[model samples]
Target: MSYPWQKLGLNADQQADSVLAAMTDGEKFAWLSGPMAIPLHKGEKIPAEAIGSAACYPSIPRLGIPAIQQSDASLGVSALGGVRPGDHATALPSSLALGAAFDPDLAETSGKLLGREAFCKGFNVQLAGGANLIREPRGGRNFEYISEDPLLTGIIAGHNVRGIQSQHVVSTVKHFALNAQETGRVVADSRLNEAALRESDLLAFELAIEIGQPGAVMPGYNLVNGEWASENPFLLSKVLKGDWQYPGWVMSDWGATHSATKAARAGLDVQSGSNLDECAWFDHPLREAVARGEIDGSYIDQMIHRILRSLFACGAIQHPAQRGTPLDYSWHQLMAQREAEQGIVLLKNAQQTLPLPPELSRLVVIGAHADQGVLAGGGSSAVTPQGCLQLEGVDFMGIQTPKVYHPSSPLAAIRRNSLAKKVDFVSGDSIEEALNSAQGCEAVIVFAQEWRSEALDAQGLDLDDHQNLLIEQLAAVHPKVIVVLQTGGAVTLPWLNKVSAVLEAWYPGSGGGEAIAGVLFGRINPAGRLPITFPASEQQLPHPKQVDPSTTTSLPGVKVKGDIFQIDYNVEGADVGYRWFERQQQKPLFPFGFGLSYTQFSYDDLQLCQSSDTVTASLTLTNCGDRSGSEVIQLYIRPTSGRYPSRLAAFRKVFLAPGESQRVSLRLEPRVIAQWETTKQLWHIVAGEYDIFQATDAATPGLCGTLTISAHAFGYRVA
Candidate 1:
C-alpha cells in the first residue's frame, strides 16, 4: 500500500495541512505529547507496540501516520540498560573523537551508521546531533558534544545531521542553546547577551540547520536568559522560528516542559518523555487552555501541521522504521575503528618514542582493563555491546547508567601486532604490583582513564583513584614509560615530563583497541587534533570553579525546594576554548587544533583574495618527513582593528604521502569575521584589513598574509 504522504501529489506543507484537517481534536492532542518508551517508575508499563527506548508517540493508523520511536544516540544506537535483552549495536567513538578527525565526510558516515542502526531497531527519531559548545571542559556530557569553536562544531554537526536524515531518520540538533554544563542543568539559568549568544552557541545551530536541515530541534532542560529554553520567546518565537524561519518542530527535553498555553504560544511543538514532567502539560492542560480561549484552536492545528510536516519531509512517513532488520556488524565495526584510528591524538612523543620497535623483547600493559576492553562514556547514550563490561554508575530519572566498556582488548591487539618476546598485563590496582611486573621490561604502557557521564560534572581535571600517583611512581622507576589516556575530555597531566610518550585517546569506540595498536605499531599514523583546549589549571578559566546552585542536593532528577541558580556566561561572552586563552593571555596545557603526527608537515606560499564579502585563503602544505600521514590545515583570522580575537575561519584534513605537496584554498565563514549587530538584527562586516594566518594550531601560526574585505550587512538567517 502506498503511504498517505506519498499518495498525495502535494508537498510536505500541503500534505501536513491535509492530514491536520482530517484529524479529530483528540487525535491532534495525542500527537503533541508522549511518554518515555521505557517505564521509569516502579509499576508503570510500556505502552503496546512501543519499544523500550527514549520515547514513543503513537501512530494514527486511519491517517497512515507512523509512530515516532525516539532513541538516545550520543555515540550510537544507545540501548538503555539493554531494555531489550541480548540487544547490541555498533558503537562509534565519542563525538569529540569525530571532532578531532576534522573530517566532515567521516562525521556524515558516522551519522549514517547511527541512523541505519536506529532505523533497523525500529526508531524513527534519533536524538543524535549534539552541537552545544564545550564551554565547560569539566562538563559531564562534553564527550557527547562536538567542539568548543562555533565554526568547527557547526560544520561537523551539520554533516552528521545530513547523514542521519539521508537514511530516512529524523535527526535532531539539540539542547538548543547555551546548555554547556550538566550541573544544575534542570534549574540553572544560562545568562548571556543577545549578540554574544548569536556569535557562538546560536551560530553553531544556525549553521547546522542550514547545512543539515534536520527535521527536529530539541531545547535543553535549562533556562536561557531567565526563561526556560523550551518556552523562551526570544529563543523559540523570535530567533529559531522567526529570524531563522526554521520549518521543523521544537521538542522539549525530557522533563523540561513547565507550561501548556505558554509553551504552545512560544513555539514548542511537542512534549517528549511527558511522564518525566510534573504533568502532561500538552494533554488535558493544553486542551483546557484551548477551550478557555486562552490558546486559539488554530495554534493547535499549526502544532500538528509542523509535526506531520517534519514526518513527511524527512521520509519518516514514507519509509517507516522496522524491527529486526539485517545489519553488517563486522563492516560497521571497521568503520568505527577507522574513526578511532584517525581521531587518536599523539600529544607527546619525546625523542621519537612512538611506533614501538618490533624487536622489543619485553613489554607490560597496565591499568584501565586493557585485558578486557576499551572504556566508553556513560549515561543514556551508553550502548551495551556484546561482552561489554558494566560497572556501577550514576542513577538518573530512575535509570541506572553503568560505566560501559566495549569488548576490544588493547592488550590482545598489541600482542597480535607486536614482535616482542614477552608481553604481560597488570590491572594497575596495586602500585607495588605494577612496578614489580614492569621492573625489567623494555617499556611500560599505562592506560589511564577518567570516566565522565551525564547528571553531574567532573570534580576536577585530575585523574581519579590515584592513577596520577601510580603514573608518577611508575615514571620514577621506569626510564621509558608510555601513557595512553582514555578520558572523556581534557585532563591535567601532572606527570607529563616523566612519560616517554603520551596519547590522548578520547573514549575510543568499539574498534578503539585495534586502532590504538595500529598507531603504536606504525600501521596507522596519528592525525587527530585537540577539539577543546586543555587548561594548565582551573585558575585559568573564566570561572576558577564551576558555579554551584544554592540548593543542598546535587543529585540530578531530584527537585530541591526553591532550587534555582544562574550561570553568568557574560564573563567570557562568546570567547570560548582557545579564544578565551588568547583573551586572557594564558597558555593552555595544549592548544586547540594541536596534534602531532609521525611524519612532519610544513606550510608555505601563503596567498589571500577577497570576492565581495568573503575572504579566501590559499596555501601549500607539504609532508617533509619520509612517512605517509594526514594533516589538518587550520586557517585563522584576526581583525587588524582588534574587534575580536583570532577565530578558526576554515579547516580541512588532507592525506599526503612522503614528500607530497597539496595546494588548498578555503573560504572563511562570514560570521567568523563579521560581528553580530543587535540593533540592526543582522551581521555587519566592517570594511577593513584583516590579518590571515595559516596555522598548525590556534597558538602556532606558521604563515601570515593580509586580506581586505568590503563592508556590508547580511541577514542573520542562514540561507
Candidate 2:
C-alpha cells in the first residue's frame, strides 16, 4: 500500500509527512529541539571550550535520516570552538558594507562562499542571510543587517540566500520581525500599526522569502506588537506561513523561547538553545505537554515535518558533511578584499585629496591600529581570523570578543602602492604625539573606528575614543586631512567640514587593508554608496533617544526591574531612514545612495512607461571624467496621492569607462508602488500621476519624469 506522497517519488513536504507518519511521539519531540548533548572527544558531555556542538539534531538511523549539523554563519563560519591558532573562516565585510555596494551579484557571491565554507567545515545548515532593515543607526546589530530600505534589503538578502542554497546547504534568513534594536531587546515590543508593519519591516521579509526561498528562519528575541516573536501568531503563522507562504521551518534564537506549547502552537518549529544553558524549552516540556493533552500530537508532527522538509529540500541529506577540510584561504581572502573595495563609500573628496597624487613624498596614517589589520564588528557576526587572540572577558552570554587581526596591513599596503617614501604612523598614543606626527606631512589619513556588537547599543552617534577631537586637532594642523572611518553603520561626523576626504568603511573584513590601500592610491575607484542616511546628529532621528522609561537592560545573571520597552514604529509609519528624514525636512550628513567616485557621471534621457501593475523606466548614464568607474542608478517613486513621501522602487549598479554611455531599463515591481491599505487589508494603488526620479542620491531629484495611471484601470493586488 504505497502512499500517494511516496508514489510521487518523495518531494520535501511529502517526505516530511511520510517521516512524520513513521515518527513516534518521543522521536517527534526529540527532532523538534536541538544541540543534542553528545560527548566531545569521548567525554560524556560537550566540552566546556566548545559551546554547544557546532550543530546538532538527533539521528533516526531506522528512517535513514541524518542528524542536522549547523553552524552560526552570519559573517563566516564562526570559529566553533573559538578562534584557536590556525582556526579561521573567511571574514567577509559586514552586511551593511554589502548593502553599500548596492550590488546583488556581490551579495550572491558572498552567500555562495559562506555556504561553501560552512559545508567544508562539516555544517549543513547556515544561520546566515540576516535581512533586518537599518531602522536605527545606533542599533548594535546594524553591521549584520542589509540596509535601511526594504526593497534593497530584501533583494540583496534574497540573492545571498540563492547563493547559499545553490551549494545544497540550508540557509536561514533571520531575526524574523521588527528586531530593530539591541537595547532592551529581549522584552522590547516593536509596536507598529498594521499598515506600517505591512509596508516596511514585514514587506522586507516577504520579498526576501519570495526571492531567496530560504530553508529556515530564526525569529528574534524581541516582541512584535505585544507578543514575543517566537510565539507571535500574526507574525509567524499569519504573515510568514499564511500570507507569504514561506516554505522554511521557523527556529528560535538561542534562549529566545519562553514556552514550549505556545511557541509550537504559534508556528515555531524548533527551539535551538545554547550549550551554556542546558534547558531545552521545546524538548521535555513539549513532550510533557503532549502527554498532559496541553499540546496536540499534530503540532509535534508539524514541528518534525518542517525540520525534515528543509533538510530534504536543501539536499543536506544527499551531500556529504565533513569537518576540518582545507580551504582556499588565499582565494577567499582576495574575494573578501574585493568586497571591501566595492563597498567602501567615498563620502567626501574635496581638493582631490584622494587618489593621492604621485608627487606626494610624505604621508601620515593615524589610529585604528592600521599596521596590524582592519577592525571587525562584534557579536555573532564577528569572524575570528586564523591568528586572532581570544579576549579574556565575556559578554552577558559567555561569548568572547574576537580580537582576531588578519595579516592585511594598511601601512604595508600603502607603502607598497603609494609614491610616498616617508610614511608616518600614529596609534593615538597621545594627541600631542599624533599632532607631532602630522606636522609638515603632504597628506594625513586618519583611521577612526567605533566598537559595536550585540547586547549593547552605542551610547550615541558620537565617535567613541575622542576620535572626533583627534580628527579636529589633525584637521586644524594639517592642510590636507583624510578621515577613513571603520564603523558598523553611520556615525555623526562633527568634523565633516574640516576633513579633506571622508570614506565610510563599515567594518571592512580581512582583506580590508589592501582594499583601502587600492582606493587611496588610485588603484580602485570608489563606487560604494550609503545604505542608510547619516544624520548630522541624534536630534534628527525619529526617536531622538532609543531608550526611554519603558526600556530595561538584561544580563546573564543580573536582574532588571522595569516596564518592558515599547518601541513605537507606528509613529513614523513606514518612514524609515531616508523616508523619515525626508518627511521631517531634515538635512542628513550623507544621504542614501550617496557615493563619490574619482570620475563623475551624468544621468539623462529619463523615460517612464507603465502598465496596470508594473512600470518600466529607462535612463542614460555617462561617465563624464577621464577615468573608468561604477555608478548606482537609483529609481524612486513618489505617489502624489499621499502614500509614502518617497520609496526606492529599483536600483542597478552600472560600470562605465571614460566617455562611455549606457542606456539602462529597470522594471518596477507592483509592490514597490503599492500601499498597504489598513481598512481593506490589501495592497492598493491610487490612480494618479506618479513622479519617477532617476537620481544619484535621495537628496537629488536628478531627472524626473511623470507617468499617469488610468483611473478606470486602477489595479488592486489582493496580497
Candidate 3:
C-alpha cells in the first residue's frame, strides 16, 4: 500500500492531512510524547527500541511513519555518556566560536557535518541550531548559542538549520524565546515588554525561521513574562503559529512540559523526554482530556498533521537514517580544524608579540592541561571524542557530567611548530614552581580556562585568583607573556597590561591544539571577531549581579510564588551587548567585532544608498600590511533622534592579500533600522536622518555617511 507521500504531486501539507486521517487515537497519542532514550537513574530500564541518545518517538508501521531518532547538541553529534558504547563523533568548536568567524557559509558547513554524522548514526532529528541571544555574559550555555546580536544570530543559525535539513534531518532552532541563563532556569521568569521582546530575542528567532525554515522549534524551560514558555499562548500561538505562520511542530525541552491541556492548547506539538518530568503529562492525561471533550479532537489531528508534514517535508520518512554508514573522519577533522582557526580571536597583540620567534632558545608552557588536551564545555552539548580526558565535574539531574578535554595537546602541537632549543611544560599549580621553571626562558605561554555548562552560570568573569596571580608573577619576570584562553565566553583580563598577547580560543573543538599552534606560529592568520562584548568588570553590566531566585522577593508584574522569580530584562530592553555600552556611555575592555590580525586593513570610498525600505552601504576595503589576512567590516546605524542607541546594521568578513582591494556592499536588513510598534504589531521605520558608520568594531567608527528613510511600517511575511 502506497502512502500519501508516495503519491505523485502531493505537497507536505496535503500529505500530512491524508496521513492524519489514517491514524488511530492511540497512534496519535504515541506520537505526542516519549521518554528519554537513555535511563537517567540506576535500575530504570531503557526503551526496547530506543536508539539511546536524547529521545526517540517509536515508528507507526501501519501508517508508514518512521521512528524519529534524536541526538543532543549544536557543536556535534553528542553521545550522552556514551550510550551507544564504542561510538564517537567529530566535535566542532563552540557555537560562540562559529559566531566569532562571522561566516554563515561556515555555520552551514558545520551544520552539514553534524547532520551527516547524525544521519549515518541512525538519527534523523539533530537537536541543534541554538539561536538564543547572549543576554547574560555569564550564561552557562552561551557557548551553545551564536551571538549577542539578533541579526548575526539569526543569519548564522538559519543557515545552520538549512544545512541540517538538506541532509534529510529535522533541525530545531531553539529555546523558543529568551532563555538567557541556566541558574533557576525552570523557575525564572524573563520579563520584557512586547516591543523589547519583538526587537531583540524574537527578532532573532523570526529571521532564523525565515531563512532556515526548520522542521521543529523547542521552547525553553523558563517562563516568559509570567507564563511558562511551553504553555505561553503569546509566544507559541500568537507569535510563532499566528503572525509568523510557522508550519513546523513545537517540541517541549526535556522535562519542560508543565501541563497537558494548557500546553497542547498553547501549541506544543510534542513532549520530549517525558521521563524527566514528574509524570508523563502528554500521555494518558492528554488522551483523557480529548475523550472528556476538554480539548477538541481536531486539534489533535492538527498536531499529528504538523509532525507528519515535517517528516515528509524534510525527507525523514522517505530517506530513513541508517546506522554504520561510512564517513570520512580525516576530512571532517580537517574541517573542524579550519573552523577553529577562523574563530580564534586575537584580542591583544602588544608590539607584535605573537607569531613567536622561531629561533628562541627556550620556551615554557604553563597550566590548563595544555600538555594533555584542549578544553571543551560541559553538559549536554559536550561532544566526547575518542581518547578524551575526563575530569570530575558537576552533577546535572543525577547524571555526572565530567569536564571533557579532547585529545589535542597544544604542547605537542607547539613543540612541533617551534624551533626552540628547549621546550618545557609546567602545570602552574604553584606560582613559585612555574616562575622558577620559567626563569631564563625566551618566552612564556600561559593557558587559562573557565568551564561553563548547562546547569550553572560562571561565578564571575575573572579568572581564578590563582590563575590571575600566576599570570601576574610570570609577566613581572618575563618580557613576553602570551596568554591562551579556553573559555565559554568573555572573561576579565585584570593582567591585560602585563601580558604581551592574548588569544581567545573559545573551547576550540577536536583539532583545537593544532589550530592554536598554527596561529601562534603565523602559519594561519587570525581573523575571528568578538561576537559579544568584554566589559571592564562586572560592575558595568546592566545588572551587576545575576538575580538569585532564592533571595528575590517580588517583581512588578509577576505574582510571587514559591521558588518562582522574575528577571527584569526591561532594564536593558532591546539594547544588548555593545549597544548597552553605547547607551550607558561605558567603555568595555574589548568591544564587539574587535579582533587583531597579523596584517592590517584600511577602508575608503564610503557611500550610502537608500531605497523604499532598505539602506545599502558600500566601501573599498584594502589590505595595508605585508601579509594576507581577513577583516570583519562592521556597519552600525543610529537615528539622530531616537531612544535607542546605535546597533549593528550589517557586516561582512573579507579575505585579502597584501595591498589587495575590493569594493563590498552590504544591504541592511529592514528590522535592524526599525522599531516594533506595540499597538499596531508591526515594524515601524520613523522618517528621519540616520547616521551610518563603517566600523572596525562597535566602539571604533572609521568612514561615516547619512541616509534619510521615509516613514514606513511593515509586517513580516508568514513562513
TM-score of each: 0.97, 0.93, 0.98
> Highest lDDT: which candidate?
3
Candidate 2 lDDT trough over 10 residues, lowest sum: 551-560
Instruction: Put down candidate 2 lDDT per residue, 435-526, tens digits, no spaces.
Output: 99988889998889887787767789889757888999999998899988888788988889988999888888878889998999899999
Q: What are the Cα lDDT values of the candidates?
A: 0.90, 0.81, 0.90
Look at candidate 2 and give me any clashing residue pairs.
388-404
Tell how far residue 178 is off in model 3, in angstroms: 1.2
Ranking by TM-score: 3, 1, 2
Tens-place lDDT digits, model 1, residues 1-719: 55445554789898888788789988888778888888777778886768888888788898788788899976998877567888889989999999999999999999999999988988888998999999999999999999999999999999999999888899998999899888888988888999999999999999999999998999999998889999999999999999999998999998899999999999999999899999999999999999999999999988888888887887888788988999999999999999999999999999999989886899999999999999998887788898888899889778988888899899999998887889999999999999999889999999999898988688888897579999999999998899999998989999999999999889999999999999987999999999999999998988767766754355333233367777778888989999999988899999999999999998889999988666898989999999999999999999888788899999999999999999999998989888898888989888999999988899998899887888988985544
Q: For candidate 2, what is the lDDT?
A: 0.81
lDDT of 1 at 33: 87
Instruction: List clashing residue pairs in candidate 1.
Output: none
Model 3 stretches with alpha carbons more than 4 Å out: 553-559, 716-719
At residue 139, candidate 2 shows an lDDT of 91
